[model samples]
Target: MVSTVEVPEADAQFWRDWGDPLLVSIVDATLRANHDIRIALSRYEQSRALTHQAGLDRYPTLDVSGDVSDRRVSASQAFGLSRAHRDGELHTANLSVIWELDFFGRVRRSVESQRADTEAHAADLAGVQVAVVAEVTDAYFRLLGLQRRLQVARDNESNQADTLRLITALFQEGRGTSFDTERVRTQLAFTRSRIPPLEAEAAVTANRIAVLTGREPAAVVTMLDRSAALPVYPAQINAGVPSELLRRRPDIAAAERRLAAATARIGVATADLFPRFTLGGLVGTQALGFNTLFQRDSETRVVSLGVGGSFLDVGRVRSRIAAANSAAAESLAAYEQTVLIAMEETEDALVRLSHAQAEKAILEQAAEASRSAALTARQQFEGGMVGVLEVLDVERSRLDVENLLAQSATQQATALVAVYKTLAGGWPQLIPEPQGDAMAQR
Candidate 1:
């Protein structure tokens, strides 16, 4: 089914180019400051260090040893040991080298496994980057939506208040009944009630964005205090094909890299079942006199080639191999699952975006019609052609539809973010650095 899907350049950067500058800046800041992303980057560094350490095993190892000591001996003890009684200084130095031959390819396989592990960690970091950006973008859009809803509610409240005043004036003048005045007041109160909760919800969403950006919640609330309009999105989204998900989605890439690492580890484990070979040598000189420490006559040399294997614990080695194979199998399954999830999320986002656009269009028309109806009803009521309740009902319906319109716009924006996230849209190429360092660079 995926094979039949239209594919584009899935790895392209859509969000950075298309998103609002403020939102893009927020996402960039979050990527650099968000603790989760920092943690993943740290893990990537650790993996790189491990890989380098593993590669070091491929080269010969060398070390230097030296010792200097002074001792005073008693006359009887000195005579018994060396036929001399005196205070003496002794010095010794040694340089040793050990190189393990990769006859069974253990070192190579281990290095390969570590390299794959490092790549897996890099992919993990990318996945975290994608997640943080998406989270911040979603929060931003939601906050804007709530703010717009609050504005609509307030506008409705004001309109209803004006109606209540007119109705109260009419009742006082003996032109309207007390029941109509009370009903208008009640309607105004209900409309006013929606404001506080919407404001609170908007504030919470702002706090979420602030936290995502690694700032204090109150500080974020202050920063985002200025009312802003909802962002505009491009009419058409270019979502690449389904198969592009394998390369574009970080979770899929991470899962695949982990699978590769697991496969490499199986080879590493298998290498343990074979004989290990090493060659070690030491060349050093020791002398009783410090001046003669480097003299040829004091030179000592040793060299050896060694081979060892686990003869008794064969079952343990096989068990490890079996475990590695099992892990590889699990990673493979995880990779498949990741691919499916990426595809599902992308498809869902596409569907949501399409529906939100359609709904927004319909709601826009409904809101306009309601506004016209409310105006007509108000005019009719003033002329004694309609009751106050009829005007109130139409105004309330207009408010409801306008609120839905605002929410639908938010949904469309959020769905766009989801699509970009599912496509792994914004992150740059791999240049792993510490969080502090990355931020400093920015």
Candidate 2:
């Protein structure tokens, strides 16, 4: 249940100012260029056409015709008596109307079935839209995470360099042991090694975003040179009950639409077991010359009606009904499964965000303690109270804690993205409007 208490709108300005421009652009591009969405739209169009065709089944068809011809026959082959070398011209004009009388409701049922299918396709399109939004959001957050991690690596590398320099200077002056100097140098090298891999990872993520945005990878890489930081959340978050989420989820709606379509198909199959009726009429004039084709004396009219039913197709109709029922059942199952998955995702993201926040708090304390211990060790070593190894060990612990803090921050950002994905609230609004001139320039 939604809370009756008023909830203020979230202030996502940081995410908006930094990531929104790129994320919106990418989401719009993906919506316009994604192959699957395009395919689904085409399928919807096809269903609309089929629905129109089905509706037409209840109407009469009119055809107009006109023809002119010349004929010659030998006297011996002519009926009765005819002179040799005889030629005649014939001209005819006609109008015909044909209609199927749907007394047994077969046409009505077919039309209903096609209408249901059309609705199903429309829902499928909506589902595709939701999926695309989720994917783009996830990618954008992941790219941000990678960028932040790279920054952390760089900062850690710089810190290690500073520590190594201090240790080397002390060792040269005989104030620190050789082992302490070597250990600092080793840690510095390891920190530096991390930079290259993190940079590569960030590059790969940028490329993936580029592909989603339907742009060249190099172009995205050129555009994304800014530092990455985790996004801040609003003071309040609203998570309605399970029912609210189920109703909001696009996949569940799509599956339900499919079930409706399948149920309609059963009606269509059942209608097929009944008889069909058709009415046809022809009004025409025939004459030996075009001048008399429309004359009252030459006019002829005919009206015909037909009804047909298949007595041998009972088994086939029953099989179709059974298949449609099965399909409806399958769709219901799928809808339930989608609901379960969406709930699972929301709960998991919530847990992760809370845990990461707690972890960040602990890690902050650990880092502060390590920093103090390192400072104390340095003072002790200068006063001849402790060895250089003690100072080096504390410094290493501090660096590790700092790295863990950075990781936790990234995890929190990822959790926020996951929450957005689960909610499926972002759509055309979250994505940017198209700028024709900007796109043309690109």
Candidate 3:
């Protein structure tokens, strides 16, 4: 039996793989509102307009013009009269045509160069997306980590305070030494010092996220209230092969587009070495009065074809071609360098994540063991099996281990974000708005 319901098609998410709903919403908002993204988008729009403008040279342009004049001249003032210096009111109008015949492919190459530039701008926009997304993710996780660290420090301070009270009462009763009391006070003071720095960093990170989302720094102060919740994603993606980097990296694509544009510009420059063919003509009527302007006999027509080129300035044209060649060569090198940097970043992030995960695992076990040992040490000290110094040492070790574990976990999360940034391949193709009919080429 056929099902009675239809399933909806899924649309592309602002990002992929990371499945946190809040993250998805924030990223979507940033992509829409971020100033850097808007700037890149505007540059892409300009390139599109320039591409259409460049294509305009491949067609003839027609212009309509007219003039009306009253003239008077004396026969005696004429040097040699062809009808004793005729004078009259004159009226004229015409439609003019001008076209550069692109026999040397100059116009075609120019259009190609501009089209490639447009593609480069599109890729640049995507690159900006990758960077901004990575930044927001890093900042979000950093804030969470700082909050956790602050909580850990405050808890340690509270624990120290309890220990200090116990030592103070014992000392007052002549059961504890002065050294113990002073040691506990100093430990509490040290624990209290960590909170301020952590609080500062968390506030700063929160402000950064707010700005990233195009809001005031105070707008998102309380937006992320959760503590140290790092959503897990695959540590290693199953990318098919290294060749996929060519398609999956926006920087690489942008560099390749730049190379292509430079190569096409070489053709544009080389074409200038040859004579440029031109066609021009006018069609209209010229009459002494407006009443006869449309008369058949008064009709005027013209047609012309000419070629113009620089013979003495050939050195300048050659120099331009040489410059274009150098530009293409530079672009090629830059493309290669971009690919190398992309690979380096990917490998670095992957290795760091792997080691961070391993380190975090070890620290997790240490943290548990340290907490258990500290608790046992406190019980033993109460029974006089150990001194206050021993208990203090164990508690300090536990605090340090907890802090390390928090940092390692945060590093691992940010490393994943970096990996995603390196391989985002480019955002979904954001096609520019359709150009007007006026820009259409025939």
Sort by TM-score, top down from the best: 1, 3, 2
Q: What is the lDDT of residue 244 in candidate 2?
A: 77
lDDT of 3 by residue, 307-359 (tens): 88763588999999999999999999999999999888877876876787678
TM-score of structure candidate 1: 0.89
- lDDT string, candidate 1, 164-236, tens digits: 9899999999999988998899899999989999888888888889889888887668767765677556556
TM-score, candidate number 3: 0.88
Ranking by lDDT: 3, 1, 2
Worst 10 residues of 1 by lDDT: 1-10
Error of 1 at 77 (Å): 11
- Where model 2 places Cα greater than 4 Å from the true spot, the runs are 1-19, 66-77, 80-89, 298-300, 367-387, 426-442
lDDT (Cα, 0-100) at 265 in candidate 1: 88
Question: Which is better, 2 or 3, measured by TM-score?
Answer: 3
Runs in model 3 lying further than 4 Å from the true structure: 1-19, 74-88, 225-228, 425-442
Score every model by TM-score: 0.89, 0.81, 0.88
Q: Which one wins by TM-score: 1 or 3?
A: 1
**Maximum-TM-score candidate:** 1
RMSD from true fold, candidate 3: 10.7
Taken over the whole model, the C-alpha lDDT of each candidate is 0.78, 0.69, 0.79
